[model samples]
Target: AQTVTQSQPEMSVQEAETVTLSCTYDTSENNYYLFWYKQPPSRQMILVIRQEAYKQQNATENRFSVNFQKAAKSFSLKISDSQLGDTAMYFCAFMKHAGNNNDMRFGAGTRLTVKP
Candidate 1:
């Protein structure tokens, strides 16, 4: 069975600062994708960043980035220059290499609060 785990239940970051959230997963498949999704008060899930298992380089998008360690099965999200708008429930997700039936699994989530 595949599973994702977010050790932190909540996190806080000052404006313009940086924060890193931890995530780990268990999976047997070698080929897959890892993602970090942020859900705001509106309840919309936004893709923060994604990392491919085959790619050795970590993924980055502006202030959002991911530290993907395939061997350790760890994928952590780093938010730089955090802003108030960044406050949201962040989730780590995993999806195996499937044709159409992509069974994506997510972690419990980490609620991040950005303080001014």
Candidate 2:
């Protein structure tokens, strides 16, 4: 069974600061995908960023980047220049490479508060 784990249940950051959330996973497949999703108070799930196992370069979007450790099966997200708009519940998810179902499983979620 493939499973993703987010060790931190909550995190807080000041506006313009940076914060990194820790995550680890257990999987036997070598070629899969990882992703981070953000759900705001509006209860809408938004895709933050994604990482392909075959990609050597980390994926980054604006102020969001990922530290993907394929060997260690760890994928962490870093948010820079945090803003009040960044305050939301973050979830880490995993999917197998061309597996049966792409049903994404989300973590319990880590509530991130960006204090201005």
Candidate 3:
């Protein structure tokens, strides 16, 4: 079984600043994918970034980047140059890559507020 944990229940950052949301996971499976998703008040789960367990390089999408520490089972998301639109509920998720099982485990979620 795999589980994701987000220690911070809420976070706030000033516009144009940077914030890092922490996430750690416990998993017996080595082959998997980790993701960071953002859901605004609209409730749409948007993919911020994704990282493969086999890839040593971190995944980045625009101002969103991940610090994937495979040994520590840590996958943190760094939102650089935060904007007002970045205010949303962020969720860390994990899914196995081997099987057809599309099941994904998500964290409790961290509400991020980007202040002007």
Which candidate should be chosen as best, given lDDT against the real structure? 1
Instruction: For candidate 2, list the clashing residue pairs, or say none.
Output: none
Candidate 1 residue lDDT tens string, 22-76: 9999999999999999999999999999999999999999999999999999999
Q: Each model's C-alpha lDDT? A: 0.96, 0.91, 0.95
**Clashes in predicted model 1:** 0
Q: Candidate 3: minimum summed lDDT over ten consecutive residues — where?
A: 95-104
Per-candidate TM-scores read 0.98, 0.95, 0.97
Steric clashes per prediction: 0, 0, 0
Q: How close is candidate 3 to the true structure, as a TM-score?
A: 0.97
Candidates ranked, most accurate by TM-score first? 1, 3, 2
For model 2, what is the alpha-carbon lDDT of residue 92? 95
lDDT of 2: 0.91
**True lDDT of residue 82, candidate 2:** 98
Ranking by lDDT: 1, 3, 2
Tens digit per residue, CA lDDT, model 3, 1-116: 89999999999999999999999999988889999999999999999899989999999999999999999999999999999999999999999875666779999999999999
Q: After superposition, how far is residue 38 of candidate 3 from its true place, in Å?
A: 0.4
